[model samples]
Target: DTRKVAVFVGSLRKDSFNRQLARALERLGEDRLEFDHVEIGGLPFYDQDFDEDYPAEGVALKQQVRAADAVLFVTPEYNRSVPGVLKNAIDLASRPYGDSAFAGLPAAVIGASPGAIGTAMAQQHLRNILSYLDMAVLPQPEAYLQFKDGLIDDEGRVTNQDTREFLEDFVDGFVEWIDRQRG
Candidate 1:
């Protein structure tokens, strides 16, 4: 069976390492899953007033997530918390009080940072929000990419052999987790 997944790349930068990680995950899951990613940079700041007519992008994002079986978040640490853009997207999906797009979704969070902690603090911050959103997050084999020079090549693809292998396994785990949650 095939499942669709909405991949959220939490960084706005073109050269973001987190985005690179998301791309790698997509490659690993290409054979078994449908990977659909939504861009967050153009989303306006979350506003309750707009709930009546959500922005075009927000509506599209919600629709994509609602159609998917799971979500994958690849984010970066910004001042020890999830980036505002990412959080904004989450808030957009979690709207209309009871009709959140993220409701009961089997989700996973993976963070990357140039810092030594590798976005640990930011991932924790996201976990808190996902808790209230009722998303089932994968708990093991956590991926925290550190500042390893040349791990990402000039083309921004993951270039390190060891990290690539680990990500392959991680993608498998994510797919299995999604299946279990659906089962």
Candidate 2:
């Protein structure tokens, strides 16, 4: 069966680079993987009391995360960590204590930033949470892209050849890693 990959775009902006990264991954993996692009925009902050009824949206988000075999986190750095909305969504899915939707899933995180360090620091911080959730993160082919002015065209297609090559390697690595974990 084709591996199911639910990609989470951490930025909600119309032209977020992270969204572009998610799109690029989808384009490359066209047939080999099933991609579910989940949105975090409408999820209200997670609260214990709300678990009773568990609004349809919250339940749907959890189902989406749980149903996927793996995840691709395309995130943006905000104040040296992932954006608040992204974190909120994760917390929402990791609900009811010890029943996290992401538990035992394989995942790869890649980030691009307009600033220098690319999102290295932010990714590390995210690791701490993912670790606690027991996620199996791919260790190789780490992607942290820095500012690349005009590297992507008006259509949001990545145009930098070097970055393009890196992305190719990254996707291949992720597929291989997913196979290994599945096996």
Candidate 3:
């Protein structure tokens, strides 16, 4: 069966490595996963007052996430932590005190970076937030890819054989995790 996934990419850059990573993952899991790239760039900074009358963009974000079978976060480290934009998106989705869009969804976090540790710190912080939001996040086989030029193409093709194999395994594990979560 195919699972719909709401993919949240943390970077706003037009050519971000994290976005490339997300695309690669989508390609790798295409047989079993249908990816919907959620837009977070245009969202206004979350305001509690708007909860009474949520903006159309915020409502759209929540609806998209709720419609998905699972969630995937592709983030880049910013000052050793999760990027502010991603945090804002999460806050916006999980707000209004009990109308969270993320609750109970099976989720996974992965990132790619030019740095050696990839986005490890950012991923850890994001995991904590996801846990608090009550997401069933995948805990094993953590992927912290050290991205280099030509590692993955803009169209999500993994050029390196080793990297492709590793990502394939990651995708397999994620599919299994989603199945287990649904069961």
TM agreement with the true structure for every prediction: 0.92, 0.93, 0.98
The root-mean-square deviation over C-alpha atoms between each candidate and the true structure, in angstroms, is 1.7, 1.5, 0.8
Model 2 misplacement above 4 A: 154-156
Per-candidate total of colliding backbone pairs: 0, 0, 0
Q: Write the per-residue lDDT of candidate 2 for residues 1-183, one digit (tens) a residue.
A: 588998889999998888877877776776677889898999998888876677677789989998898998989999999899999999988886877789999999999998888999889888888989999998989999885777666664678888888888898999999999878
Best by TM-score: 3
Q: Candidates' lDDT values, in order?
A: 0.85, 0.86, 0.94
Q: TM-score rank, highest first? A: 3, 2, 1
Which digits, one per residue and each the tens of the lDDT, describe model 1 over residues 1-183? 678989898888977888777776777677898888887888888899878877887788789899999998999999999988999999988996788999899988897787889999999889899979999998877888785766766554668878888887788888899999999
Clash count in backbone of candidate 2: 0
Whose lDDT is greatest here? 3
lDDT-wise, the better of 1 and 2 is 2
